[model samples]
Structures are given as C-alpha cells and as structure tokens.
Target: MLQATLRFAQTAYASTKRLFSNLFFEDALGVETNRPVALKDLGLAHSDRVDYDPSPWLALRRILPRNEVGPDDVFADFGCGKGRVLVQAAGYPFRRLIGIELSPELHAVAGANLDRSLPPARRADVELVNKDVLDYAIPDDITVAYFYNPFAGAIFANVIDRLAASVRSRPRALRIIYVNPVEEAAVLAAGAKLTREVRGLRPGKNWSLRKSIRMYTLAPPPC
Candidate 1:
C-alpha cells in the first residue's frame, strides 16, 4: 500500500512538473519524447539500458557549482534526450555545449528545442549530434561531461575508456557529473575517484526516489 501510494504521488508530481517545465523552459517535456520508449526499444545490443528523464533544473544548478564548472569548460551531455539539460546548461557560459543522442526522434526534438527556445547567440554554442554515444568522438577540448545514468556495464565502461584515452592524448582537466549513479562501480574501475555526492533541492521529499548523485574524476596517476 505504501509503495503504491508513493508511485501515484510520483506520477502526479511528474505530470505537474512537466507542465511547468514546458511553459517556463519553452520546450516540449516528458519521459517520452514523441512516444513512450523503453530501454529495449533503443536496440543498442551491448549496452545495458535506461529510460530518459529530465534532470531537474534546480538539481543541475546545485551540481555545477560543486564541480566548479566555468565559462572555459566545454560541456557534453551523453544521451541528451529532448535536450532539456542542454537547454538549461546554455544558461551557463560554457565555451561550447555538445549533446549526443541515439534516437533520431529525440535528436530532432532536441535540435528544434534549441532552435526555437534559445536566443541566436546562445544557440550558436550548441552542437546536437544524432549518433550512437560510442561513435560520437569526444573532442580534446571538452573539459566537462554530464551523464544522467546514460548507460551501464559495457556501454558505461566503453565511454570511460574513450574519455580516458582522450585525456591521455591531450592531457587536460576533465570532470564527469553523473546523476542516479547505478553503475558507480564501473566508473570507479575506470580510474575515476568520487569527489562529491549530493541530492536535489528538498532532499528528504524525494517523490522520484532517485539515489544520491555522485561526481567522479580521473585519479591522478600513481606517483
């Protein structure tokens, strides 16, 4: 009974928040981009799957300050669905913003959201790519990457390997902000050390039931 009631409350809260987000953010909002999509529907054979959910704007604001993200950072959002995070991220003065999404429908919506909602000057900073996350090359210049439980296991491992390789090829500061970190073990295995963990605003009142988010960075090479 308790679990069922919690679920109902969560659904109601999500609906109300979605309406508010669409109005204030000036973008289409929901777990379903065009239609409901499940993890299996994505069809990325090797990658363990997760569904899309927009990061709360307040939560994002809290995490960015903890990471010390600044104008010089080039930010990338993996599995950026409907570009809500990307759009919100534009509020910051990052050098550039990149979003990678595999679903064509979500990518199109993301592009449209950026085009329609963002001012021309801010829109210029965005690059929305429709490609498998694995195939999307991480440019050496990117210093910050954001993932909201984009994937786990193999897919997660592969992404970290690529990020590590990028750092090796062109050494620079990089930080990864991961929310709802279900595969934290994989992240730690790939050489990142946890720097911080935090919850969204109104912490004790978690209608969504998400776990505490964690920040990770590559451990300095052994002395």
Candidate 2:
C-alpha cells in the first residue's frame, strides 16, 4: 500500500515536472494540424482521447525488461502523435526508428521536438512519416511495433491484420508492444500470439486511471 502510494506520487510529480518543459503540452487541448487528429473530428473516432503519455515508450522501464528486444532493433509507432514515442524510443539502441502520424501539424511538431532533442550527428536513421497508418506499409524490418490504444478496436484490428501479415512473411522476428492496451489487446490477442504479460508498465495503484500494457509475438499460424 505504501509503495503504491509512493509510486503514484512520484509518477504524478515526474509528469508535472515534464509539463513544465513545454506549456503547449501542459495547458492545451487537442485539435491540431490542418485537419483530422482532432479530438472532436468524427473521423478520428477512438483517437479523440490523445493521451500523449510517454511512460509506455521508455524501452528499459517496462518493455525490454521482460522482452528480448535490444538497442539494434527496428521500431514503428503507429498513430505517433507529436512523435514523443519515437523520440523517447530513440534513446534506446535501435538502428532505425520510424513513426507514422496522420496529422501534418503533429508530425511537424514531432519533427521539431526530435530535432531539438537529438543532435544532427545522432539522428541519421530516425524518421517520422506523415501518413495514415492503414495506408502505410508495415516494414518487414520492424521488429517491434508500439500502440497506445490510438484507435477503435476496428481500426486496431486492421493494423493487427497488417502486422500479422508482416510476421507471416518473416515469422519469428516480430513483436507487438502495446501500452494502455485494453482495446488494443483485444485485436492483438485475437490475431497475434501472446509472448509475455507485463504489469509494471502503468503507474501503480491509487492513481486515477488504470491501464494494462502487454507484449505479444505475431508468429506464423499453425501449419
């Protein structure tokens, strides 16, 4: 009980502190870019929440601690809003990092943030594409994919289908890492095989929202 309380306090503190770094993030609501990505656009559907939380992308914090991923891996973040996940994930050892974000404005903000955070000498292989996740091809080289419940179960299902196809084309080298994965897990568990269940990804209890983050491997179907 004490530990959970302490953890929540610390997490809240950290999040608040980071907010001080950028006021737009700290004080603003959603609805950015030319169109779409709007928290209210009926088209964005389930993406309206715009959680924008980066805890799930801390590779060493909760993901790789239980999974077999490494620094040289390739990562793709679907619905990469503001590119925070990609930028945070880059701190790891990935050889190539990519993000697909539909909102041109958010993509530009993410690009700017990445440029500000990462030196030009170190950003040779990281890139973010301004494209819809459904239209973008799932790169065969992406070993790990991330989702933060960015879409409805239906949209997530489509992404899972594409991810599964990519794995079938390559077999055992692919992994799906989902944060705040209640809805996303439905799509993954139905399509992809479970590799491991990670519990420490979300902040400890006594906090406002409770979330589950899981890791799964999309292996080939039975022969």
Candidate 3:
C-alpha cells in the first residue's frame, strides 16, 4: 500500500508539473527551464510521496520556548525529511539531536546537509536513521521530540501512545512538539493530552501568507 501510494503520487506530481510548467517558470520569472524526472530515479518510496510543509519546525521553536531544553538535552525529529529540522536544531545548545527518516534517499540528503552545519567536534552528536517511524523505537534519552504531520491520524495515534508509554517506563519529562498539527485530534485520542498550544507564525520571504502553529506537551488524560 505504501509503495502503491508513492507510485501514484509520483505520477501525479509529474502530471502536475507538466500542467504547471508555465506556472513554475513564470513564478521564477523565466530564470530556468523545467524538466520532470522519474520518481525511482529520485529514490523515494510511495510513502515518501507526501510533501509535508516544513513550517512546523519554525513554529516549534516558538512553542518549545527554548528555555525548556538545556545543553545536555536530547532532541528527536520524527519523519525528518532532508534534515531541515535536524540541521536547524544543530544551531541550538542541545547536546544531542536525532532525525528519523523512512526514506534512504532523504536520509542521505539530510546527512549531507547536516555535515555542512557541523563544527567538527559537534558533528558526531547528530544522527539520521532511515526507518519507518512506526517500527522505530525512540530512545529513552530524548528530552524533546518533534513531528510535522509525518503520517495519518492512526499512525500519529500510535506514535503518541508509544511516547506516553516510553515516558511512563522511563519517568522523565519529555516534550512533544508538533507543527502543522493536522492529526491533533488523533494525538488527543491516543490519550496524549496537550499541555500547551502556540499559534501564529511569521511568513517566510517567499510565501506571503501567515500561518499559525500549535505545540502540545504531554499530560495524563483526565480520568
């Protein structure tokens, strides 16, 4: 099913590109010509077809409040694509950072991007793994975890349950930061009660639209 969805998305993206070539070129104002590549050539699986907006990473910085984590803090990004969040997180004072990516191609891309940001000694502190988030086991060492609509509500629910169980087994205050929170209801349904929500994000230079982001720290469900 995941492969099939990726294939479908590949075809759709190609079709959309062809249909919008003028738009793409026009948006760039005739700077460069555009061409379509085969999806397999890009090494993305069907599940990798989903292009999630990376807004949540930026919004997350505001919601996590920076003060919540210390220099020894461990950070994790679920479904990290090309390592945007992982690379950006490296700029902060966190002692360790990890990004989980299901796409091998994306993992390599993110690794390369992260390599560019490293200060030699600190480069070893960041790692990106190519594995499904569902099958992936998060480390007990993580003090901060982030998500950006990596999957549907069902999977989000499972991840939420897993996070709660992880903390219960380990007993440390772990914070979950979600951006572009489309599966928020599912997170709640999984018994991961939200402790806070941050709204409104400044638009990037390319995008004229302003956006709102919500963050939720875990809390025990109301009995």
Candidate 4:
C-alpha cells in the first residue's frame, strides 16, 4: 500500500513538471488533446491506423536531448495534429520547422494554433502542410523527422520507404525521432538503423504508471 502511494506521488509530480515546463508555449499544455477519430472515420481504408492522441508536452523535452540539434537542422513533424509539437519545436533554433497532416479538420486547427502560438520570429521558418504525410514530398534540406505514432502498417511502411529514398537521392545525414514506436519493426525493415530508444517519462521506484511512450532515433544507411 505504501509503495503504491509513493508511485502515485511520483507520477503526479512528474505530470506537474511537464505542465510547468510547457507554459512558455501559448496553448494549455496540461490538458490532453482528447479529440478522437479512427481511420475509418477519416475515410481511410487502412484497418490498422491508430487514433489521434497528442504526445504529452514533456515528451519533446525528454526526446530532444538524446540528439544534438541546432539552427542548421531542418525539422519536420509527421502526423502533426493541432500543431502542438510544431509550436513547441519552433522554440528551438532549427533552420526550418514543418508539419504535415492528413486530416483537414486537424490541419486547420494546427494552422490556427501555429498562427496564434508562434511568435513573429518563428513565423518565417515555419510551414504547415495540409496533406497526407505519405504524399508530401520531403524537402532535401529536412534533416530531422518527428513522429508521434501517426500511422501504422501500410501507411507507416510507405513513409519509411520515402525517407529511405530521400536519403538515397540527397545523400545527407537524417535523424528520425519516433515517439511511441509501434512501427519500429517496419522502420528497421525499411533500412533505418536504430540509434537509440528511450522512455518518454521518468520512472518511479515503487509502482508508477507504465509509460507506453518511447522515444526512438533511427537513420537510414549512409549513401
């Protein structure tokens, strides 16, 4: 009983920290983006597609440190719903920040959020693309790709294939940050080599909530 209480306390404390750290971003980060929609609801034929669930605000903070990013790098977020991650990443000094979303509804919300959340300084560097992530042509300059388990099975496979093709054509170093790596096996099959996989939450000693969220870094083989 005592162990369970301590674990609960740790989880609560960590959540509070996540909320406090995300305050610089304009939206209310503490609240979940509980908007729900299935693939069939979106008119997608894929039976394996997962529902929309925004990564917690603290996810970025925990994931970013594993890699060394700078102003020279261009970052793109796949399945960027509501543009929360895009806005948060813009606070960094990346060369450019892009978000690609398939759902017109979510894309519109993301656009509005970006308009309201991003300061004037980041406006020029940000681009919100309202299109299927698979259809969107990745820019050659884009070096980092962020994923929040946007899709799985076929859709996920196609995106990884495109990433591999992009690296083959451009011959540039690429970094992929995948949160909640459900399609990690597909990533490896597509020729990406896993660099790291780390938990997105802090673990409590006793009986903390099982954090299903994981941050992963994978890169295509060098050309």
Candidate 5:
C-alpha cells in the first residue's frame, strides 16, 4: 500500500511539472500551443488519423540539435497542427520551413501563430499548406521531416514512399523525426535507417513508450 501511494504521488508531481513547463515556454514565446484538440471535433473522424497534440518542447530540442542543422537544410512537418514544430524549427538555421496540415481550421491557427511569433526576417521562409499528406508531393529540398503519428496503415506507407522518392530524385540526406512512431515499420520498409530513439521519462525516471521519438535517416540513392 505504501509503495502504491508513493508511485501515485510521483506521477502527480511529474504531471504538474510538465504542465508548468509547457505553460512557461508558451508564455515566453508568446504562442498558444498547449491545447489538445480531437480529430472528431475538427470534423476529421477517420480511423487512421489521430487527434492534434503539440509535440513536447523538450523532445524537439533533443531530436534536432543546433549543430546538426545547416543553412541549406529545409524542414517540413507532415501533421504540423498549430505550427508548434514549425515555430521551433524557425529557431534553427534551416533554409525554409514547411507545415502540412490537413484540417483547414488547424492550418489557419498555425498560420496565425507563425505570423505572430516568427520574426519578420524569418516569416518569409515559412510556408503552411492545408492538404492531405498523400496528395501533397514532398519537396525535394526537404532535408528534415517531422511526424507525430498523423496517420497509419496505407496512408502512412504512401507518405513514406513519397519521401523515399524525393530522396531518390534529389539524392540528398533526409532525416525523419517520428514522434510516437506507431507505424515505424513503414519507415524501415522504405529503407530508412534508425539513427536514434529518444524516450520520455516520468517521475522517478521511468521510461514512457507513448512519449518516445524515433529518428531515422534515409540515405540518398547511390551513383
């Protein structure tokens, strides 16, 4: 009984700490991205699609180190709801940032957030597109892609295939940052090599799989 009570207390403390940390970042950046919205609420009641949840700030910082990013690299977020990742990517020296959101409502919110948060100089390089991922062609210049379990099954496979094709055509290094990688097999099937995995830890340092993020690199086609 004592052990169970201690565990519960630890979990509660961790949750509260996370909430305050997220609020602090949002306030510091002057952006509102902590809200979670359901797909059905946005009229996207699809079995394969998940709801809109902003990626944790810590996860992004851990996955995309500043030293790894270059001026020539272009970053794209596949299900960039509310532009949280795009806003974070703007802090890097990437040549451009693209956000692809399927829901028009969320897309509009993301655009507004970017307009308000990003500096004038960096605003021009950010682009937000409201279209299905499968229909939209992955830009050849996109060197980094971010996904947060946007969709599964055939949709996920098709998107990975498109990423692979883009690499084949342009022959450039492509890095995929997949958060909550439920359909990771599809990425491996497209010949991507797992570079690293970042796991989230709760209070007491217990790992949580649900908050894990996986990084994969797709090599350019050989000459």
Candidate 6:
C-alpha cells in the first residue's frame, strides 16, 4: 500500500509539472502546442505512426545548448507535430529549420504556430513539408535531426538508413536528437554513436521512458 501511494504521488507530480510547463511555454511563445492529438483523429490510426505529443519545452535546450548550434547547422524535426520543437529551435541561430509531417492537418498547424512563435529576426529559414518521412529525402546540408519516436520498426530503420546515406555522401558532422528513443538500436546499427542520455524531468528513482531524450552523432564514413 505504501509503494502504491508513492507511485501515485510521483505520477501526480509529473502531470502537474507538465501542465504548468506547457501552459507557461505556450503562452510565453504565443503558440498553441500543448494539445494532444490522436493518430485516429488524424486518419492515421491504422498506420504505424504514433499520436502527436509535444516534447517538454526545455528538452531541446537541455540537450543542445544555444552556443553549440553553429551558423551552418540546419535542423530538421522529423514528424514535427504542431511545430513545438521547431518553435523552440527558432530561438537558436540555426541556418534553417525544417519540419516534416505526414498529417496535413498537423503540418498546417505547425506552419501557423511557427509564423506566430518565431521572431522576425530569427535567422533560420523555416520550412514545413506535408508528406511522409520515408518519402522525404534527408537533405545533405542538414546537420541536426530530431525525432520524438515518430515511428518504429521498418519505417524507423528506413529513415535512419536515409540519414546515414546522407552522411555517407556529404561527409559532414551530424547530430540526431531522439526523444523517447524506442528504436535507438536502429540508429546505432546505422553507425551513429550515442553521445548523451537525458532522463525524464520528473524527480524520482524511476523515470518514464516517454520523457527521456537521447543524443547521437553520426560520423562520416572512413576515407
């Protein structure tokens, strides 16, 4: 009984933290990204895609510091739902920001959110593509890629293969920020090295997998 009570308390605290964080960030940024969307609602219930749940506001900053983002770095958010990460990334000095989403509804919402949230002086060139991630080719100039466990199984493997292929061709430094890395093995198999692991924000001995973030770097192939 004592253990159960402790678990409940932990869960409640995490939920409260998420709620306030979302409220604060969304309001401060002038964007609406806290709402959750089901795959079924977006007509992707039968597909391999997962529902849309924005990552914590501070997740990106916690992993990649502002100074670490170079002027040449082009960031892409695979399956960027409602552009929460994209908006957060806009504060950085990335050369460009790209968001690829399979759902047209979410893509539209992401575009709108970016327009409202991104500052006029933001240097990144923002692009929101409404298409399947598998169909979208990973640009060679992209140095950073972010994923929120967008998809799993064969699809995730295929995407990683494309990312690796891009690195093989361009031979540039690549960093992949994967939140809730359910398919981390696929990334490692594609020759990416895990550089960092960030647990959930909730304070406890037990951390939720859904709130974790992993950072990986893919090196260019041997000369």
The prediction achieving the highest TM-score against the true structure is 6
lDDT of 2 by residue, 43-128 (tens): 44344345344443343346655245576589888878776666666667787889887767677877877776676865667878
Error of 1 at 19 (Å): 3.7
lDDT values, one for every candidate:
0.75, 0.65, 0.65, 0.71, 0.87, 0.86
TM-score preference between candidates 1 and 5, better one: 5
Q: Which ten residues in a row have the lowest lDDT in candidate 5?
A: 201-210
Off by over 4 Å in 3: 1-49, 201-211, 219-223
**Candidate 4, overall lDDT?**
0.71
The C-alpha stretches of model 4 lying farther than 4 A from their native spots are 1-45, 200-223
Clashes of each: 0, 2, 1, 0, 0, 0
lDDT of 1 at 40: 56
lDDT of 1 by residue, 11-107 (tens): 7766776677666554443323323356456654344756766676555676777347677889899999888788778888788999998888778
lDDT of 1: 0.75
Model 5 C-alpha lDDT per residue in residues 16-108, reported as the tens digit of each score: 866886677777777778788898987887888878988887777898789999999999999899998898899999999999999999999
Model 4 per-residue lDDT tens digits across residues 1-223: 9778777877798677556645643335332243556656767635655566676665676667624788788989898877778877887779889998888877887877776766777777889898877678878777888888888888888888888788777776677878767788887776666766556345563222233444334454543
Alpha-carbon lDDT of model 5: 0.87
Q: How accurate is candidate 6 locally (lDDT)?
A: 0.86
Candidate achieving higher TM-score, 3 or 6: 6
Model 2 TM-score (2 dp): 0.71
lDDT of 6 by residue, 15-120 (tens): 8877797678877777888888998976787456878988888899989989999899999999999999998888888999899998989998897888887666
After aligning candidate 6 to the native by TM-score, how far in Å is the CA of 84 from where it should be?
0.6
Superior by TM-score: candidate 3 or candidate 4: 4
* Highest lDDT scorer: 5
